[model samples]
Target: MNSFFDGYVNSKTTLRLFVNQYENALRDKVEKENIAADFHSFKSIVPCINHYDIEKQFQSVYTNSKFQEFQKELTRKIYYYPTFIKKEGAIEVYQVTEDMRIGDKRKDVVYDILLNEEEFEVKCSCHHYEFRGILCRHVLCLLREKRIKEVPLKYILERWKKNVKRKHNFIRCTYSGMEDTSVAKRFDMLCNTFYEVAEVGSISDESCNALVEAIDKLKILFSTNLDNSAKDLHVQEGPSCDGKSKTILSLVAVRSRGRPPTLRKENKVDRKSREKMAREKKAKKKEKENNVKGHSMEIIKHNMNDASSAAGNLASQDEIAQTVLVNSSAHYNTFQTA
Candidate 1:
């Protein structure tokens, strides 16, 4: 069915598409120097999104194939600019007024693009050439629209929706055991990007060294910590609150204390009893009404019979009176006292 929401514009995505189209059109209209100048002008005029923040937000969601596709699309818009992903689609701009349930905030923004038929809203932040992630505000905005969950990755793409084969091949390196030369280089990289200095005893040191990127490795050192904390608290409801959670008795701490009233065990019987009583009352009322209706019908039938009998008797009486008058007149004409 073509429902109410089917025709509604995706305000955010439309605005994003508009901005993208506008940027591209302006670039095409100008010289290379003008493009560089435009970049500078755009930076000064528009708010910039932080690259690090976006990268961190994206890191958790990047494993999905759709997200990877979006990344590829963004890459094309920038360095690749491939002709395969057609740029002929119309970029529509719109505005949306969303009332957030949680924060209770109403947002009004100059929309960038309501693109991909409202699949996603395209937004820009100054830090990088790539798209922005679901910032808390963006999430709130979507929730206000009653979207219920995070926006999917496909709607944010700037290029083809398919993943492209990586252009660069991995190069293998030979290692010598003496100095562990890769370690120092990796350590320096980590220090620059992450913490300033990794402790000797810390697992941060493991990723700091060149042997491996610190994806999820090096948790052995903190295994005991993770176990003690994870076992204590539930992962679903909340994070470990000082790790004091007990499995069974934790509810006791949260539950109110008092001499509570006793609860009935046989609630089903009570409900059934009440329902039976109500049904009996309804049936009795119906029977009484039926009896009244029957009595009224009998009375009406008797009244109609009485009316018919009275009319027949009156007609017979009229005929007899006429006959008697005719007889009297005939006797008078016959003459004499006889």
Candidate 2:
């Protein structure tokens, strides 16, 4: 039973904020030297990594276990090179036909390697690039076998890069303590002072203790000022002519271009009355249908009775004509005998 206006604050944005904070925390744990070894090629493209996404690789390391395992798997390829299948124009095909031990169990895992020598485009049957946006061990092995030192810029994804653009100011709509213009200005000044205090307080424990004491004294001063302001009779000045008090304009509700609606014109019927009318309408429709059905049945019965009576009358007339014919024949025979 959620209302239409329930999500005033975007849930996705809020969730993203939490995720960014988590990433930032993980980013602090990442060692820059480790990134230099693993993502050396990435450093050439971007000068400095985004502080927020500094631990992107660290997060990916735990999430993509297959990728971490693949790094170790590439060592086995050093012993054997993939079988060359065929070369068609710019593309070359290589096949890994033998069974390899992956993870726990040894299984027959066949992978076709398609390489474009001219364009440096590489594709594998395992589709590791499509799945995880990184090259599989098979392709990496091929590169190592070919003595390619650096990974191509085309293959490296921008999102996985260390120096991708970072969003600094994410604060959109934040609440201000004061509503009045003058109060808001004073509050801004107070915030500046608080920020300075916080910087000084962070130096040492003694300084922090002194800062706390000062804050308590500042609160007392603010309380006294609040009391003085409360006691003062503030006058609200507005537009005035000469020495006379200004007249405040009243807000009038504007009427549309139509005659004012009378109370009788409005549909003020209660819910019960409306429902009763609907029920009556439905009942009348059902009664009308029943009456039509009854009339049709009565007409059919009358037609059947008229047809039966007509058939009975025709049979009686036929019997009477047959008796007359038999009597006339007997009289003729008697006259002849006489």
Candidate 3:
């Protein structure tokens, strides 16, 4: 002790004393306040998760229940931690000791999985702290043995969801005394959107269904079944119509009216006097409608004639077709005999 003190006589001695005193102070505060304690969920998961095989690849990795249980505890520690502990009201403690391998091995093998009795290193695929939201292949392998169809909702909601919120740095629980105006506005809008769409005391499934229903209703309400622009155009200039079908071909309608060739500016529409324009449009529309009705009547007459002709053809060819079929079948038989 004297030699140690003598070696750091001047500046070094002061620094050493300072570090030692700081460490002592921090240690005393922690011990006195009992600051180190796992959350409630930690205690609950420790017992429940104590003995679960996480690896079907090597189910023998954890030969004992103790190791499996320990592995679960380790999972909660790595994945749940602050969120799980905060939420799980039942658990008050979660504790585990280091593992001891049979023969001395490399550091990698030693701690690959040393949480409780759980053979984590061998069984656990997600060894790191993150990547716990969705079950890794290793956990799924274990769950399959236990016949768990899917990862538990408890793990997904309380454990995984909370972790995701923390990782992504989600919204503050309450925006108390927040200074960012833009953030506050956006948050408010989000809340408004949710409340507007979601009913009181609705479950997630119902809420999602309700949102879909609302979206469908909105779509229907905003849908355009008819073109209002056509109505407006009809009222505005009588009819800028040609006797032909309404098309790009009839845009030069006035030219076909035997008037001197007159070119309107690119964007301008030369009506050839509004009264004359109105007369042409009315006459053109009457002509077009008459033509359409005549065309429809002709189509109907043609269809009826076609059906009649087809019927006569079928009746006349029926006997001939049957004779041909009989002759072909007989020929096939003759070829087989030859």
Best candidate, TM-score: 2
Rank the candidate models, highest TM-score first: 2, 1, 3
TM-score, candidate number 1: 0.22
Q: What TM-score, computed on C-alpha atoms, does each candidate reach? A: 0.22, 0.31, 0.18
Indicate the worst ten consecutive residues by lDDT in candidate 2: 168-177
lDDT of 1 at 119: 48
Off by over 4 Å in 3: 1-155, 160-163, 166-177, 193-338
Poorly placed runs, candidate 1 (over 4 Å): 1-266, 336-338
For residue 142, give model 1's deviation from the true position in Å: 37
Residue-wise lDDT of candidate 3 within 108-148, one digit each (tens)? Answer: 22122211122221224245323433333333333433354
RMSD of each: 29.5, 27.4, 42.2
The residue-level lDDT of candidate 3 at 288 comes to 100
What would the per-residue lDDT of candidate 2 be over residues 88-149, giving only the tens digit for each residue? 99999997655779889898767899999788899999887888776776786777667666
Residue pair clashes in candidate 3: 40-91, 50-68, 50-69, 51-69, 67-117, 67-118, 112-121, 113-121
- Top lDDT hit: 2
